[model samples]
Target: MVALNMTVDSQTGERAVRFNIDALVIAGWAGRNREAMEHHIAELEALGIARPKATPTFYRVSPSRLNSDPVVQATGENSSGEAELVLIAADGDLFVALGSDHTDRKVEAYGVTVSKQMCDKPVADRVWPFSEVADHWDSLILRSYVIEDGERVLYQEGSVDGLLDPRDLIKRYTGTDTLADGTAMFCGTLPAIGGVRSFTTFEAEVEDPKLSRTISFRYDIAILEDVG
Candidate 1:
């Protein structure tokens, strides 16, 4: 079991909580807008990745890959990060956080599930109660930045409108509206700003315009040579 030392951004105040996660699900091809989702699929196909057999596919990964640190290591530079909203179910309560579904593009062509498990998934330490943002959920936005030539560039920016509603996504995954206990799901991501590319430092965040709050995190990438 992977224990995440997370913080609850409750209305009262921020409180510490240790969430022991046993299952980590990454939802792919989950854009609510079929047009936008197809744009992403075609984008990947341009790079030799085949389309998913079905939309909103759920890929199961080891819970241990969920990481909270500010530094992540990749075997090479053939990987990039995608901004995503994260859902966590713990102690009978559901909370929402921001995360990056950093993936190995090279491995993805052959096997996406294996590629997902190849890198550490970075998530913010703080989260908000699902109830707090549930009402104005569509007003929320997901964005990401990539460091290129020592300049931070907007890699992706979009409203959650492009993605599936949290409830709908959860139902599709577990045959229910609520997530099982200790489950953390990466809800899916927006397409890239310019195009999909690798970076040395990747940052991601989620903004709730209604609540006037945001949760974010960044990680430096360490590229190690592949030993064969």
Candidate 2:
């Protein structure tokens, strides 16, 4: 199990709670926009994957990579990053945070499952209790930035409304009313503003306008030489 020390703050004092992650589910092609979804599928196809079926796909990875560390190590330089909404089920309570589903694009072409296992996923330290944000969930915004060649650029920006509802995704994955405790799912992401690109550092945030608060995190990437 992956142990994560996450912080929660409010009228009460801030506390660092150790949570054990039992599963990591990465949801793919979950955009609500058909054109955008097609765009992503075409992106994957360009990398040599066959045409995708007309349904959302879920890839399960080892919980050990569901990390909060501010740095990630990659085996090569071909991987790109994207921001996504993350759902965490801990001790029978659900929480939401911002995260990056960093993937090895080259390896993904061969097998999405194996590619997902090649890199560690990074997530924000602070999270909101799902119940607190459930009423205003649609108003939440998800965004991401990438540091390319010493320049920081806005890689992605969109509303959570652009994706399917969390409950619906959970239902599709678990075939139940709620996710099992210790499960963390990285909900789908929006289309990149320009195109998918590799980065030296990745940053992302989840902004709740109604509550006037945001949860953000950044991580640097270390590309290891592929000697194979």
Assess every candidate by TM-score.
0.98, 0.94
Q: Give the TM-score of candidate 1.
A: 0.98
lDDT of 1 by residue, 32-142 (tens): 999999999988987788899998999999989998888988998898999899999998999998888989999999898899999888999999999999898989999
Q: How well does candidate 1 match the true structure, expressed as C-alpha RMSD?
A: 0.8
Quick one: how many clashes does candidate 1 have? 0
Per-model C-alpha lDDT, please? Answer: 0.91, 0.84
lDDT of 2 by residue, 1-228 (tens): 898888874425567777788889999888777887788778778777656564678989998887878788898898877899889998888888778899998888888889888888898888888888888787899889988778888988878887878888999999997999888999999878777767889989888888788889999998899999
Candidate topping lDDT: 1
Candidate 2 is scored at a TM of 0.94
